[model samples]
Target: MRQYWINFKGNQEGPMSLEQLAQKGLDETAYVWHSGLADWVKITTVPELNDMLNNSAKAAQESPAELPEQEPEAVTEEVPELETEEVPELPQEEAIADEVPSLDNVIESPAPNYGGQQQYAMPVAPQQGPAPQEAPKCPPTNLVWSIIATVLCCSIPGIVGIVFAFLTKKYYREGNLEKAQRMSDYGAWSVIISIMLGIISMPLSCAMNIFKVAM
Candidate 1:
């Protein structure tokens, strides 16, 4: 006799014979396994279980009908009664009136004088600072002389004088009074140098011309 195993309700049920398996009233689709089989198969596919399955079906059909279902007994539950309670009544109170204070009940007193005892603070004038010193005036820039020298005398020194003259005016406008004064002196010197060169060059040029005519 060959024993079989089946998975029933998530558990490996048994190494039971086909006769015992048929007694379990298993469905045709139930999975069964034995050592002879490579994998679990449905009972309906097994030739050995065919006769047992047919017998089980015939026996289920010929079985006597189940007794008519008995009607469930009607349940009767008893509920307990609740007791009632009585509350006592309280006495009523009388209303009270508001009271006002009389002047005769209060004592009178006089306010003290503060006439000469308090000293008044006098307002003090803010101290004035010495008047701001006036800014010194800009020295002569000699711009007119520098321009005249640049036009009529030596160009190099005359152009230098004109540049210094412009610098003097620019520095004075920019609030640099000391630098402006120095630039003014420089412009004056350049103008004087140009005038001196013009004077000396004129005499030398006249002497050369006289010599050339004599030769």
Candidate 2:
């Protein structure tokens, strides 16, 4: 007969007989005998011993002496700053003058008549006294002129040509060849004027460049 301390339920109450120990949840498979220790060791047959060991370990971990609170370290970072640039302003008079060339130089041209001699030409009938004139049958020529004018009117000239082209196209489509021709002519003139203005501005631009260098 041998005696050993064993825990059961929630209390330690073991001084029981070996047979009683066996009846109280102790089994031969639950314990290993250490003959060198000279004692009959109580064995545990409970399947939850691993869980109990884990819980004991967790309790040991949670003990204040086992784990101390650590102070968090502060982190710092370097940031880059963006550089801003200032924009230069242009003279108001120069801006206004740049727009004036396109507006002021519109010139109208006369319409030509082939007198029914050309291919795809419309025949012109002689008018009797106060005869009503028939509408012209050609596609609107103002579209072509408008396109040309728009190209030439770049900067300021383009604005004037576009306006003239629109107005002239209306009259031209209504069988007014004179008005259409006038619009087309004005668009051509605007192109020429714009080119001349651009040429004249080149010298001023060159002078400004030289002045800038000298300054």
Question: Largest TM-score belongs to which candidate?
Answer: 1
Model 2 agreement with the true structure over 1-215: per-residue lDDT tens digits: 22223433213344343334434543222321211111112232121222233333454568655433210110010011011111101221233235323212111111223222331221121111111122233323344544554564345775666666676666644545567677777766666666677678878889999999999
lDDT of all predictions: 0.52, 0.37
Look at candidate 2 and tell me the lDDT of residue 9.
22
Clashing pairs in 2: 102-157, 153-157, 153-158
lDDT of 2 at 81: 8
RMSD of each: 52.9, 47.0
Clash number for every model?
0, 3
**lDDT by residue for model 1 (45-100), tens:** 45445445655566566644421211111011001101111100000000001111
- How well does candidate 2 match the true structure in TM-score terms? 0.31
Cα TM-score per model: 0.38, 0.31
